[model samples]
Target chain A: MTREQEAAVINAVLDGDVNAYEYLVKAYEKNVYNLALRMVGNSEDAYDMSQEAFIKAYNSLHSFRGDSKFSVWLYRIVSNVCLDYLRARNRKATVSLSVENDDGEDVELDIADEASSPQALLDRSLTRDAVRRGLQALPPDHREILLLREIQGLSYEEIADTLDLEVGTVKSRIFRARKKLCAFLIKDGNIPDYVSSSKLRGGDLS
Target chain B: MNMCEYYQELISRMLDDELNNQERKVLAEHLSVCEECAAVYSAFSMLSDTVANDLVEPPEELAEDIMAHIRRAEMRKRNQREQRAKRAASRQIRNIVAAAACVAVLVAAVGGVSVVRNLRRSNAVYESRKIESSSGTTAQGGLVDATVLAPTPVPTAAPAPSSAPVSQYTAPAAESNDNGGLGSIIRSWWGGDDGWFSSPAPTPVPTYSVPQITPPGYGSTVTPEPYAPQVAQSEAAPIVVIPDTPVVTETPVVTEAPVVAETPVVTETPVVTETPVVTETPVVTETPVVTETPVVTETPVVTEAPVVTETPVVTENPVVTETPVVTETPVVTETPVVTETPVVTETPVVTETPVEPQLSMAQPDTFSDAFIPENSFAPEGMAGTPGMDMSFSALPDFEEAPADFAAVSAVSYDFSEQDCTEFVNAIFGLEEETADDAQSVQTDAAAAEANSGAEQYLSYIDKLIATEQLVPVTLPEELLPDRTESLTFSHEGFKFSLDIRFYGEQMCVLGCDGQGQQLCFMSDMSAEEYDTFVKDCLLLNEVE
Candidate 1:
C-alpha cells in the first residue's frame, strides 16, 4: 500500500478498530523479521523480537504523527526491539543469524533453489558457512550496520533514521563496518586474493 | 596520514553517492595518486559485494506469527478492561453505602437543634435535592468530558455508578476529577494541554456514569451532539472537585517512553562540514568548456582563405575564375582604354557604367572589323536590301525588330539585355501581325521555358561539380574576350565558347569549339537554325 493508504489505516486503528493495524504489520513483517533475525542471530529470538516490535508499534500507533514514511517508522521500532534484546542479554559475538525451515531445522535461505541438489548444496555450503562465520566475527554494531546497508539496501537517510544517527555517521559507520568485515574474512582466508586485488576495482562499496 | 584519513571519509561518501561532482573529482584524483587509499576502497567494495549476494530470508510464518501476537494482545487488553470495570462497580457500590450512612448520621446529629428552623427550611433542602437529581442526569456529559480532556484513557473501562443517592450525586464530580489528574500527567509528558485540567470545573459536574455508544456507521462519522445534554447538566453545579489517582499514575508508562529515551541519545557531532568544500567549481568549469568550442571553430575559417569568402557561390564556383578570364583577358590586352580595369571585374563588382558606349566605340575600330561580312546577303528577317555594307558602323535599320521575337542565349556569355526577337521569329515561322500580340506570345513562351530549362541546367551544374568532371582551364592570353560578358566552359576533351556583342546596330552571336572550328550566326534562316543547334553544345560540351 502507499503511504496515504497506510496513514488512513493507521487513523482507523487509532480511532479504536485495532484490527486495521494488521495491514501495517502484514506489510512490514518480512522486512522487520529479517532485520530482527540479522540483529539477534537466531530464529527463535528473532521471532520473539519481531512480535514484541509489532505489538509495541500497534500500541503506540496513536503517537505516529505521520512525520516520516511508515516503513521507516516501522523499521525504527524493529531495530530498537532487536537492540534492546541484544543489550539485555549481552549476547556473545559468535552467534549465527540464519533462517529455519518448517521443521524447525536451521537451513540456508536460497531464493533460486532449482540448483539446490545435494551436490550444489554441498558446494555452496562451504562459502555460505564462511560468510556467516565472517559476519559473526564482527562486533554487533558493525554487523548490524553492514546488514542494513548490504542486505536491506537502505539509503543513508533511512539507515540514519533507523539507527538514530546522523547521515554522515551512517556513512562512516558503513565504511568502517565493511572494512572490518573485509579484514575478518581476509584473516580467516575466506576471501580469495582476487577480491583484494585490482580485479575488485569496479565493485560498489556503499 | 591525515590526508589519507580525510579521503577515507570522502571515499566512503563517494561510495554512498553522497559526494558532489567537484568533491568526487578531487577524491578520484587523490585516489589515483594514493595506492593505499585505492586498495582500502577496493577491499571495502569487494566485501560489500560479497555480503550483498549472501542474503538471509526470514521464515515464511513470521507475518502470521506477528499478527497472532498483536490480536492476542488486543484481546488481553479488552478482557482486562472488562474485569477492571466489574471491580470498579463493586467497589463503587460499597463506597456509596458508606457515604449514605455518613450523610444520615450527619443529619441526625444536627436534627434537634435546627428542627424548628429545618422544618421551615425543609422546602429549601427539597429544592436543592431536586437540583442534585439534575446532576445525576449528567452521566453522559461526564464521559464526554473525560474523553475530550484526556484521550489516553481511551481503551480503559468507564467508571461504574454508585448505588447511594449521595454517592450518585457526586459521581460526575469524581469523573471530572479523574480526567483532570490524567490530563495533568499527559500534559507533563507531552508538554501540551496543560490549561485543560488546570482550571476547576466551572460548569455543573455530572455525577453519574456516562453512556458509551458508538456513533452510527461503525463510529466513522462521530458527531459531538451525543455529549450536548451532558454539557447542560454539568452547568447545574460548580463546586465539586474529586481527586482521582489510579489512571493518572498508570498513564506514565504509556506516554513517557519518548521522554525517557530522548535524553541519553549520543549528540551528533557536525558531520556536514565537507559539503561546502565541494563548491561550484564543477558547474563553473562545465559552462566555460561548452562556450569555448564555438570560438575555437570560427578563428580558422576567417584566417585561412579570403578568395573563398562567400560561402557557396564564390567557394563552390572556383571554376568561374578560370572560365571568365576568356572575356576579360582579351578586353584588357586589346583595348588601351580598358587595360586599366581590375582583374576581378566580372559580375556586378565592377560598375557596368556608361563605359558601354566607349567600350563599344573601341570594340568596332578593332575586333568587330574582322567579324563583319561585306556585301552580306540579306538575312531572312532583315527589311534592308542585300549587300548593304553590313560592317559594324554601316549597318542598315531593321524596323525595330518588333518585340515579338524569342530570346536566345549561347554558351560562355552572360546574355545581358539582348533579345534576338526578329531573328528567332523569322526562323521559326512565327508570323508577327502586331508587336504587342507577338511580344505577349513570346514573353509567355520564354517564361515557361526559362523555369524548366534553368532548373535543368542548374541541376546539371550540380552533377558536374559533385563528380569533379568539370576541370577549370585558363584561356590562352590571345583568346580572351575584350568584354567580361563572354564565358567559357569545358568538359571531356572539348571547350565551347560564346560571345554576344553589338556591332553598330546589328547583334552578333559567335560559337567556337576546341579545334578552332567557328560558327557565326548573324542573320539568315539557316544561321538562326544553327544558333538554336549550337546552344545544345553548351550543355553537352560536345561538337559534332
Candidate 2:
C-alpha cells in the first residue's frame, strides 16, 4: 500500500473501525511472513510470529509516529518478535561472520580467484536453495538486515531507521553481511569464486 | 584486501543504489580493473535478486485469526465496560438510599415530641434513646432533666433515719422492674412501631414506674447515711456488701432506739439551755452584782489608764517635737546645698562661653577653604566665555568643588550665607526632581514585580507538569482554563471527558458525564492511576 493509504487504514483502525486493520494485514502479510520464515526457518513458527507481530502492532498502533514508512515500522516489529522467539529458543547464531582485527576494523575474507567469468558462473550456479541455505546459515543480525534489505527491498536508510542504526553502520554491516553470505555459498560448494577474464589481476585492485 | 575494502563497501552501496556519482564512478573504474571485487559485486547482486524473489505466501487464515483475537479482546473490553456501568448505577442507588435514610431520621427526631417524653421516663430508656438520637440532636431537652430528677425523689420521701436498711433491701427489686420496662420500650420503638409516632403513647406508662420506684429505693438507702448517722455507721457497712442478711439481722434493735432517742436528743438540749438561762439569771442578785462590779471596774480602769498615760506621754510631746525638729533641719540644710549648686553650675557656663568663641574662630577658615574654590569656579566660568580658557582654568576647580562639597557636607553643616542659600535652593530642586524620579521608578518596579510573579507561577506549573502532578492539556475553545471543568478526548475510538478538579493540594482527574458527576466506574482513582489515565488521553490525542 502507498504511505497515504496505509496511514488512512491505521487511522481508521485507531478510530474504532478495528476491521480496517485487515487492510494493513493483507498489504504486508507476504513480506512479513517471508521475513519471519527466513529468520525462523519454519512455516508454523513463521505464521505464529507474524500473527504476534501484527497483534502487537495493532495494540500499540497509537504509538506510531509516522516518522518512517508504515512497512518499515511494521518490519521492525516483525524482526523484534522473531528475534525474541529466537532468543527464547536459545538459538544463538552458530557462525560469527563479522570478525574484528587488532585495530577493531572488520576483517574481510580473502576469496581465492578461479578461472571463470563471474556473471556466467553466478547464472549457472547461484540456485535458490543455495541462497536460502546461505541465508539460514548467517548469524541472526546479519540475516535480519540482509532480509530487510533484499527480501523486503528496504533501502539502507530505511534499514537504518527500522533497526535504529546509523546509516554508515547499515552500509558497512550490509557489506559485511553480503561477504559472509558469499563465503557461505562458497563453502557450501554451490558456486565457484570466478573473476572476470579481462582483469590484469583482480586481487591487486584492492 | 585493504584497498578493496573501501571499494567493496562502495560496491555494497552500489547494489543498494546508495552511492553518489563520484563514488559510483570510482567504484566502477576499480571494478573494471579488479576481478576479485567484480566477482564479489556479482555475487552480492545475484544474492539480492534471489532473496527478493523468495516471497512465501502466508497461511490463508492468518488475517482471520488476528481479527478473531482482536474481536474477542474488544468483546471482553465491552463486557468490562458494561459491568463497570452497572456497578456505578448500583453505587448511585446506594447513595440515594443512604440519603433517604438520613432524611427519615431527621424528620422523626424533630417531629416526634411524645417519643422524647417516653424516652425521659426510664433511666435506661433515656440512655438507649440518647444513643439513637445522638446523631440527629444533642439529646438534651427533657432527657437530661429526667435523669437528674430520677435519683432524687426516693431519698426525700424516706427521710426517717431508721428506714436505711429497709430502702437498701428494696432497691434491687425496683432495679429489675426498671430494666424490664426499658427493654419493652426499646422493643416497641425499634420492632413494632414504625420508628416515628405510634410507639410513644404506650411507652410512657411502663417507663414511668422506673424513675419513681428505682430512685427512692436507691435514695433512702444511700442518702440516709448522712441524715441518720448512728444507724448508718452500725448497719449501713454490712448492708453494702451483704445487704439482705445484715439489714434483716440488725434492723430490730437499731431501728427503734434511733427513731425514738434520735428525736428527743435532737430537741432536748435546746430546750434545757433556754429555760435555765432565762429563769436563773434574772432571779439571782448576788451573781448579777458580782459580775457587774468586776466588769464596771475593769472597763474604766483599763480604758482610762491607757488613754491618759499613752496620750500625754507618748503621742503629744514626742510626735510634735521630733517631727517638727527633724523636718525643719533637713529643709534648712537642703536650702543651702541647693543654693550652692547654682554657683558650681555657673562656673561651667562661664567656661563654655570661651569654647564657643574659639570654635567660631576656627569655623570660617574651613568654610572659606571649601567654598572659595566653588565660588571662584562658578563666577569665572560664567565670566569667561572663551572655551579654551574656561576649560583650562575652571575644569580642575570644578572637579575639586564637588569633592569639597561632599567632604564638607559629611564634615559639617557650616556654610557661607550666600552659598548656604544657593545650596538650599539646589537641594529643593533636586528633592522635587528625585520625588518624580522615585515615583516613576516605583511604577517600573511594580510592573517588574508583576511580571516576575507571573513567571514564577508559570515555572511552578512547568514543574508540576514535569513531576506529573498536573497534566498540561489543550482545553477545547468553549472551555475556560480557569474554571473547574472537563475536556473531551477520544481513546480507543470512544469519546470521553475527564473532569479535572483540584482537591486542596491534589489535582483529581476523574471520568465524568455531561452533568459533571463522576462516573461510578471511574471513582476515586489513586495518583498513579490518574497519571496513567492522563497519559493515555495525551497519547490518544497525539495519535489523532
Candidate 3:
C-alpha cells in the first residue's frame, strides 16, 4: 500500500470501521484466488476459498500484526484454510483446469445460439482447452505459485508476503513449479518448439 | 554455488524479476546450456499462464447470503442484549426484595432465639440467684433449688451473677411445689411448658376448672372456667405448661418465625402498670393472650416468631426495640384444628338445648311485596342434599320464597337425587342414579295429603317434580307458614307438576313452627312443553 493509504486503513480499522476492510479484500482477492485455485485444483473451490479467506481476515483482523503487509497475512490464512479443506477432502482427487488438448477429437461448442460469433467463441473455447490441459498436467503446488506470479501479477516480494515465506523461498518454488509445467506442456506438444528468442539480459531468453 | 543450484535459483528469480541484470544474464546462459533447469523453468511459466486465464468466478448468491447472515447475527445479539438489560432491571428489585425478606427473617429469628436463650439463661440464672438470696431464708437447700426460679432475664448480662445455685438436675414435682400443693401447678402453667430444667415431670397438670378457649377449630365451645384468678404475673418468675387447644386459645398472628424454629408461643400475662412487662408469675386461665396488639390478635405473634427466623434484619420490624410490646406477635391463625372430642361435647348440647329454630318473625296479616321469600326468608344454606342439616350462609339473592315452614324445611329435602344422578350420568355419559329419594318425596306427599284434608293441611311439604324442568325453590318467612303456590316446568319432553299445601311448625329454618306442605308429582311434559316452549326458552335465558 502507499504510505498515505496504509495509514488511512490503519486509522479506519482502529476507529472500528470494519466495513472499510473491503478495500483490502478487493486488492488481494485475485492473488488469493489464483493461489487457492491452484492448490485445490478447481474453480468452484478457489472462489469459495478466496471469499472465505477475506471474511476470516475481516473477523480476525485484530489479531494481525504490522510485521507483514495485509496481503501476505491474507494469503497465509487463505492458503492454510484451502489446504486444510483440500487435505480433509483428500486433495488427490481434485482436478485442475479442464483445458484438454484435442489430438484428433472434434470439440463441441457450448455457444449454440445463431447470433453468437462462432469464430470468437471457438477461439476463447480453444484457449481454455489448451490452458486447462497444460494446467492439469502440472502438480497443484507448482501450478499455484506460477499463476500468482503470471495472472495475479504479484511481485516476488508480494508473492512471498502472500505465501508467508521468504522472497528466496518464493523464487525457488516458482522456478521448480515452472520447470514441471514446461515439461508437461512440451510432452502434450501444446508449444511447437517455442523458444522465440525473446530479449535476455545478456543472452537469448531461449 | 554449483551450476545446477545456481541455475535453479537464477531461473526462478528471473521468472519473478527478482535478480539483477548480471544474474539474469548468467541464468539465461546457464539455462541454455542446462536442459534440466530450462525444462523446470518453462513448465512453471506455462502452469501460471493457464490457471490464471481460466479458473475463478463464484456463483452469485454467496455474497448476499453472507450479508443476510450478518444482519441476522446482529439482530440476535441485539435481542439478547435487550433481554439481558430487562432481566437486570427486574433482578435489582427482586434481589432487594428477596434480600429484605431474608434479612427480616434473620432478625426475627435472632430476636426469637435470643429471647428464648435469655429466658433459659434467665431461668438458670434466676434459680441460682434465688438460691444465693434464700441461702439464709430456708434451711433446706435441697427444696430451695426446686422451689424457686428467681432472677428473670433482665436485658443486661449482669444478672447472671445474681442467679442462685439451684440443682441443674430437674427435681420431682413434689420438690417443685415445696410443700405448697398448688404452687407448682401455677408455676408450671405460668412458664407455659418450656425448658423445665430442674422442675421434673411437669406437675401432672391438675385439672383446674380452667375455661377451655376452643382455639379456632375445636368443633364446639368448651366449658368456661369459674373462680380463676390472675396471680402476681410480672414478679413471681413462674413457669407454666400450656396444654394444647382446650387449654389455651390460639390468637391469629403472623407466622414470621425463622426456618429452624421451635416457636413456643409465650402467651404471657403482661402487667397493666407503666412497665408493661411479661412476668413469669401469672394465672393459667383462658385469658386473651398477648394484649390488644394494635397489629393483630396474639396468633400473629406466634406466627411472626416463626417468620422472624427466616429474616435476620427486616424493614417492618427494624431496630426490634424490645419495645415492651406486650402486644401479641403477628401469628398465622392455624386452620380450624378441629378436635374430635370437642365436637362430641358441643354439637350434641346445641342440638339438644332446644334451639329457638323459630325465626320468630311475625308474618304480616296481608303479606306485601316486602314479604317476598327471596327478600326476607329465602333459605340460605340448606342445599337440596338429603338429611344434611345445612347451616345456611352464602346463599345467592332470590326473588321469591315458597310458602310454609315445611317447604322451607324441605330446602334440605333433596328429592333431586335421581335427576342429580342422571345429570352426573350424562356428564360421564352414563345411566342415572336410582329414583329412590324422588319416589319417597312422591309417596311422602301422597301420605301427607291423605292424612289431612286439603283445608287442614298445615303439616304438608311441597314435593318438587321434574316434568320438563327442575327448579330449586326458596320459601319466605310468611310463606313458610303455609303452602302458598305451585310452579310447573318441563325437561327433555318429560313432564311433572307439584301438588303442595301447608304442614306444621318449628321444624323449618328461622322459626320454631314448621308450616308443612304436601307435595304430589304430576308426571307429564309433552303438553306442558308444547304450551310454553318459547316462554321456557325465555326463562332459560333469564335463569342465569
| Candidate number of the best TM-score | 2
Q: Give candidate 2 misplaced runs (Cα > 4 Å).
A: A92-126, A192-206, B111-114, B117-544
Candidate 3: Cα lDDT at B373: 24
What TM-score does candidate 2 reach? 0.40
Per-residue lDDT, model 1, residue A54, is: 86
> What is the descending TM-score order?
2, 3, 1
lDDT of 2 by residue, B226-344 (tens): 11112122222211211111221121211211111122111111111111111111211123321111111111111111111222221222221111121122222222221221111
lDDT by residue (B1-544, candidate 3, tens digit) is 4567567667667666678989888888888887656655664454445555655644455454444444465578679999999999899989998897677667646655544443332222111111000000111111111111111111111111111111011111111121111111111111111111111111111111111112211101111111111211211221111111111122111111100011111111100110111110011011112222211111111111111221121111221212123223221122122111121112111122111111011000011111212212111000000000000000000002221211211111111112222321221222222234434443564475633211111111122123212232444422323321111121122111111222232111111001211111122233333224323332332210
Q: Quote the positional error of residue B237 for candidate 1 in Å.
A: 60
User: By DockQ, is 1 or 2 better?
Assistant: 2
Model number with the top lDDT? 2
Provide fnat values for all models in the order shown: 0.48, 0.69, 0.32
**What global local distance difference test value does model 1 have?**
0.34
Per-residue error for A45 in candidate 2, Å, reads 1.3
Give the lDDT of residue B223 in candidate 3. Answer: 19
Ranking by lDDT: 2, 1, 3
